[model samples]
Each structure stands twice: as structure tokens, then as C-alpha cells.
Target: MQEPIQNRKIIHVDMDAFYASVEQMDNPELRGKPVAVGGGENRGVVSAASYEARKFGVRSAISGYLAKKNCPDLIFVRPRFERYREISAKIHKIFYDYTDLVEPLSLDEAYLDVTVNKKGNPSATLIAQEIRKRIFDEVGLTASAGISMNKFVAKVASDFNKPNGQKTVNPDEIIDFLEVLPIRKFYGVGKVTTDKMYHLGIFTGKDLKEKSLEFLVKHFGKSGAFYYNVVRGIHNSAVKSERIAKSVGAEHTFDENLTSEVFMMERLESIAATLERRLKKHKIAGKTVTLKIKYSDFTVQTRSKTLIYFIADKSLILDTAKELLYQEKMKDSVRLLGLSLGNLNTEVKKTIVVQLKFDF
Candidate 1:
């Protein structure tokens, strides 16, 4: 039997418009103005946009041309990935300082298991407040935090407040919160699932919980099990830490398409350097190097090389990337390039491997 979820304490922290916030923090001119990070031309996409720009319906991944059409006053600028990475590192350090059981969903968001934290803190709410304050004071950025008894609820609570805010949902309030929340707010419920739920009259968590697990499974496949459990506030997933990274990669979309090998090599060197830094930071090495290329026409392809031993050196990474890049014949000018290191080392446990089994 498992313990009830009323005892757990989890927190989800999400940085508000991460890239755009960083831009605003670095340049006072961008503050309180409509700003976006990406290309200004028709061909580019918005990587991140300020809340001011979002009001005009600008969004990340939307084409720069479309963004301009939505908000003519939107200011577009290229992404500063190096700076973002630096800020991410600082925020990550803060999370670790609270609890080692921090699972990063991205550079800007993370789920933390604070049931038993390092600071000897009794209340998860206080810890969240401290984290939010530290991020603003130390990193010059604002973040929203959510505190709950489980990961699912914590994530949802975090978004209840907008930029530079924190929200806590105590165990007693969980039921009421879930009852009123739309079904679409469930973590794994994307467009397709939400549509399916709508067809089934499952518009809210209460509606979802009314259905049988068998009935949900019959219609929704494997994810139906997740829906059944989540609606009832029964999630057993722990904050996992020892997940082996399958690959380490760095990519950049060029401001202008480059057909010259010399320019491509220069970009590759930078990517390799970034990858090497990440690998070292994680104390990881890889034996395989993969290069990804995107053409101006939007077609993409990848080439990879495998080595005998794990390597994390900058020179080795760049060499492999260069070799992989030239190995493929160019079909068009390249618009984006990426490099990745993979095939990490895994620990072997003799006792686990030697487990005895008896057939009945």
C-alpha cells in the first residue's frame, strides 16, 4: 500500500518569458516596451516575446512576419543563447541549494521535490518565496512559483499567477482547484486528447474522474490510465534525478543563410565549444557526435560519427562536427546548424545483473 498524497510537498518554478526577460534585465530600454527576441525579417521566427508584445498576439515559434503583422511596434532582436545559458546555470544552482531533487523541464522551468529539503524548512510555501526572491535579487529576473502536494497540481498552481508571482494550493484546496480547472489544463492533455475528451463530455477534472479506467483505456489507449489516475489526484511519479542524458547538443539559426564552408565551420566551432562546456559541467562524455543541418528551403538532415572512446574535448567535438558537415553534399544554403555528443557511459552493477530467478 502507498501513503496518501496529502503529505507530499512539491514546487514548480517557471521563469516568465525567459529570453525576453533577460533582454529587458540587460537593457533598460527594452523594459515596459513591446520586445521580441529573434529575426526582424520575414523569414525569422520569434524565439521569445515580452508580455507587452504577447498582448498583441505575438508568440514564440510564430514567424517574424506574422508577429510584425500582429504588432507592428514589436521590436525584434537576435537571441543571445550564451547569456540565456549563463542565467540558466545560475538559476539551476539556486534550485540545488534548496534540494538536489530538482528536475529541470527546460532552461526556464523545473519541478522540485521539497518534502525533505536541505534548508530544514518546514513549509514549502516559504521555500518557494525564497527561491522567487533569490532569482529576482541575484539573477535580476522574475519567476512564478507553484506549491502543491504533487507534481501535477504544483505545475498547474505555478501558472495560476502570472509574471513575478507565487501561488500555493494546500491539501484541503486541491479538490476544489481540480474541480474548477478545465480538462485541457492537465499536463499530458494536448489538443488531440482535449478534443477526444470533449467528445466524451469530459470537460473538467470532475467529469474525467466520473469515467471508469476501463472505459477511458478503451477509447484513449495507454494515456487513458494516466488520465484516470491524474483526475483522482493519484500520481506516483517521483522527482527523478539520475536520468542518463542520451545526448548533449547545441544549435543556432543563422541570421542569414550561409553557403560558404568557412562561415559554417566558424559556427560549428562555437557550437562545439558550447557542447563541450555542458558536457564538462555535467561530468559526462560521449562517444558519438552528430551534426544536424537545416537548409534554406526548410529541409533538415543529420550526419553522425562514432568514436572508440568517450570524448568531451572542444577540439575533438569541433573536428567531428566539421567532418560530418562536409561529408554531406550541399543541396541548398544552410539556415541552421547543430552539433550533439551522445552514447554516454553507464554504470554496471554486478549484483543487479546476477539476480536469481525461480520458475514456478
Candidate 2:
């Protein structure tokens, strides 16, 4: 059976062609014309392309040479990241005006938990409209908004109406909305995963929902549960407020106790590699390594060492973890081992800005 919808209100706001729009706004001559940020005389890639340029198949991450071929008159402008950040900060201020439960996905996109907003407005849809209006009026940038009961649906709905538009997925319509959603449109379903889904006869959310949890887990590993829940319109992940991350780490429990140091080293290596990827994805480096060891007897021991400099490389993590591992003497059979990197960079999260309310 499906769960009842939580009374949370989420709004995902995405600036339409943020960089390209900023360029057009700053220069009157570029308005309503095909424009892109990044890719000038030098051999570079396009970071952001305007809707006009997109019509000619111009897109971000494509070579400048190819972009020109796609649209002969496509204008390339180098990115001014500092300027973008300045404007992004101004836009963020607007978000803060409404609620503190604002989770910025990027400079151009954010998820707002307006459940307990400062304005005391119970309608997340109205809050979204006001935010979009303020973005256009104060920041001179058009944004698209999506409103729903949770982050996943809200984010997906945001894209349905692009370029200064908004869409709301009411609680009663969420199931219907998700049923028709393409697998590719779901969060974290990249091209590879989508192709895998296609191979498994999961073309849409409905197809995905029909699969057993065991089948999904067998096919997609850890993320299988994520897919299963999301297909049912049941994602419960909350927006997080800004905070400094204390560590980067991953750990796993063994089906059986392991006695061999060699086997334990192998597991640490795998754990270290996973941690490195997480650090890189978050663009963070840490200065401390901690090795957690759990014995079959229910005893847990941790060994940690602070490094001279921040490191996020697999080799560094593995080496540090290995040192921490070998430095300590083993006492009993091992049931679990975890590796963590401490002293990390800044991170952000939060939820329920309007305290997750709606109009009666």
C-alpha cells in the first residue's frame, strides 16, 4: 500500500539559461539572439547556451568548433564566474527572505522547503510565483518553478514548464503524475541506468513500480530501493541546511567474520576508493583518516591519524587507511570495517521552511 502524502511543501526554482541570460541582460545587443557562455577564439567548450542557440543543437559541454557549425551566428562569450556568483548571491538572498530552509543545488537551482516560511504563506505555489516574480523583477532573470509534496517530484515538475514558467503537482495527482513520467526524467537515472531499465522492460514509472523490490535490488544494487520508492512517489529525503561536513566515509558489514589481514586490507582498499569518489564528487579534501574496526565479539575500535595536508585521492586514502589498519594489532575476527576522512569542506541541507503546511 502507498503511504499518505506528508504535509511538506517543496519548491524547486531553476534559472532559465542562467549564464546565457545573464550575458543577454548585461548587454542589450545580445537580447533575443543566439548566445552562449564560454567558447571564444580559444579551443574551449560551451558552459551554457541560450534557448535560441539550443534550437540549432548548440549545448553546454560541446566543443566551440561544433557549436559554430551548429549555428553560424552563435555568439560565444567567456564565463565570468565571479559575476555569476555575485548575482547568484543576490538571488539566494531572495530565497532567504522567504524561508531559511533553502537548499541550493547550484547557483542556478535550489530546493526550498517553504513549510514554515517567514512570510507565513501556506501556499507553496503562491510562494513559488512570488519568488519567480522577484527573480525577474529584482534580478532580471527568468526562472522556472515546480511545487510538490517532496523534493523528487518538485524537481521533476520544475522542468515541465521551462523558461519563466511554473508547474504544481497536487497531492491527489502525484501518483498519476509519476505514473506517466519517463524513466530518464527520474532523479539519478542517468543514461546508463536508463538503458539498463530499458533492457529490463522498465520504460516508465509504472513499469518500474511493477517490479519487485528484490528484483530491483538484484539489478541496481543500493539504488534499487531508491527507484522503487520514487516510482511510488515516496521519496522522503529532506532538504538540508548549510553546514560543514565532518567527514567522508563508507562502511559495510560482512556476511561472515573475516580473520585474514589480507582480506581485511582488501575491504579497506574498496572502502577507501568509495570514500575518494565521494570526496571528489563533493569537491572536498580532508586532513584526517579514521579506521573503524568491529569484531565478532561486538567490540569496536577506531584508529585515527591527522595528515599534514588535505587529501582526497584514492591512493592517499588507501595509504592512510592501511597505515591506520596495520598500526593496530588485531584482537579477534572482524565483522565490519569502515574508513572515513574527517575535516571536510562546507555542505548545506534543511527542510520545512514553511513548516510543511498547506491551505486548509
Candidate 3:
């Protein structure tokens, strides 16, 4: 018989400073130094930063210019996605030795369900420890894990202990743990949502729990129901082995912000070609094309159009992006441009599986 959803065992494993760590591991000279991957002093963006660099507030998504400004000794290295994927596959193999229900969120993190694992381990905590050890032994990379009853709480706990550590939020402690958690630390609560929650006087999970579902729904729409359930330890999302891609996209941040439409159109051509290559690599096609415009002032605007048929060609993608670009007037000088294809040819049909949850 299947166990109740509440008794499920979930583990969230996250690699620390994955790209930068990989670079450091391969090149001994980079060890113990402030290293950043995929950026430089003059331009580009930092894709990842070593823990050493993070001490100085260097992080991903920030401009390389700012990263250097933060840590002058930070070393910049190019990204090697293929090597990362190879290491990721090896780490995943270690996960499968314990359980088949591995849901990878990215190349650096994944969620594993080990309630009824292949190793027949009864304690999820021990299983997480063994898995981390095996990953380090086999892949030469350190990973952190969070063990709990569900994916949401597990993912949050994984961040509690960083750089080769683990945290287990037992079933009984779930409520108290979440109640004390800052509202900003809750997964899915980004800057905009946090600001909205603060405006409503919701600073912690306890404050959020006090709000009625109707009040949250009135302010947050459908997400209010989500918050209502998760705060009460009611997230039942299962770990699926396969996840479908919703869109294929590519974006570029210019070295200099362009004010002219002609310059912007020229940039869009390259971005569309890059998007096309990604679509073809994944064999993905979509009927909807979206153009993302990021202004020099950091404001973002998007324009989208849908077609009767799907397309993956660069010409078609560029034409649609060009149309969307000219469809709107310039709000400010454009710093970044992005193009994405959605309404994909692929389908997403989720199958929920209730697991075997026996008392330990």
C-alpha cells in the first residue's frame, strides 16, 4: 500500500559555487583564491563566483565591472559547460545508486525521493550523508543536502548549511521551522513579492500564516493559495524524473547601451541566431515569440506575438523579434535584448505518485 503524502522523504542537493568550484578544482593555482567564471573587468556578466569572492559580495548576474570593483583580486575564467555537465552526470549516477526518483532542477542542483530507496535505507538523513560523500569521492566536488518531508522545505533547508554540509528538518519540526523563517527566505518569494508581503505587514512565515486565504488571494491572486498551503506544510509536489522545457531563449547585454533602433536590430539578429541554435539542439519549436528589452535604467519591457504554426528558424525568429522591437517606442536607451520562443511543440503532463511512508 502507498503511504500518505505527508510521510514522503525528499532530499535537495546543491553544489556550492559550481562553475567557479569546477574551475578551481581543475586548476590548482585557482584554489583558495577569489575566482569568478564568465566575466571580465570591462564587460560581460559573472556566471558564478567562488566562496572566497562571495565574501566580498561578488555573485552571479552582476556585471563583471562591478564584481572587480567589489573584489579587485578576483580572477575571471571562461565557462566550460561541457565539463560541468560531465561532472553533473557523475554526481547524478551516485544519486541513482540510492533512488530512481531524481528530479534535477539544474546542472548544479536536484531533488531526490528516497522514501523507498534502492539501498533500502530507512533514514533519509543517513542516505543524504552517504550520497554527498560518494559525490565527493567520485566527482571531486562538494555538495550540500537538505532532508525533509517535501521538496519545498527540503530545498530551503539545503541552504542552511553550505559548502559540504547537510541539514534535516524532521517532520515534527516543520511547522516551527517555517514559522520562524524570514518571508524573504521562502522559495518563490522574489524581490517584488517580498516587497508586496512587507507592505501587507508580513515579515515572517508566522505573519504570513495569520493572513486569511481570501486576503492573500485578493492581493496575490492564484499564488495566495500556494502560500496558504506551503506555510501550513502542505506542499505535495512529487519528484519527477523528467521535466519539460517551456521555452528556448538567448539574450545579450551590449558593451554600450544603444539608443538607435538600427543598432538594436543589428544586435537582435545575433541573439535570434543563438536562440535558433538552442531550439534546433533541443528539437524545440514554438508558436509564440517574445522580445525582452532591458533599459539602461534597469526597467524591463516585453512584447510577444503568437502564430498559428510553430517555428525554429533564425530568419523567422529574428523577423518576429524585429516586429516586436519596432512595435513599441523606446522608453530609454537599451542595455540588453532577449528573444524567446514559447507555446512550445512539447507538452507537459504531470503524473503524481504517492509514496510509501512508514513510521521510523
Question: Top TM-score: which candidate number?
Answer: 3
Model 2 whole-model lDDT (C-alpha atoms):
0.87
lDDT of 1 by residue, 1-360 (tens): 344356667889999999999999999999999999998797788989999999999999778988999998898878999999999999999999988888788889998887777897878899999999999999999999998877888898898888888889887787788888899888888888899899989999899888998999999899888878776677756666554578889998888899988899999989888988998998989899999998887788999999999999999988888888779578999989998888987552221111112110
- Give residue 197's lDDT in candidate 1 (0 to 100): 91
Please give the range of 10 consecutive residues that has the lowest summed lDDT in model 3. 1-10
Which model scores highest in lDDT?
3
Worst 10 residues of 2 by lDDT: 347-356
Candidate 3 backbone overlaps, count: 0
Tens-place lDDT digits, model 2, residues 220-332: 99999888888778877677766357787898777678998899998888888898889889899988899999887667899999989989998988888888888967999
lDDT of 2 at 172: 78
CA-lDDT, candidates in order? 0.85, 0.87, 0.90
Candidate 1, which segments miss by more than 4 Å at Cα?
1-4, 246-360
Q: If candidate 2 were superposed on the true structure by all CA atoms, what would the RMSD be?
A: 11.7
Task: Give the Cα-based TM-score of candidate 1 against the true structure.
Answer: 0.72
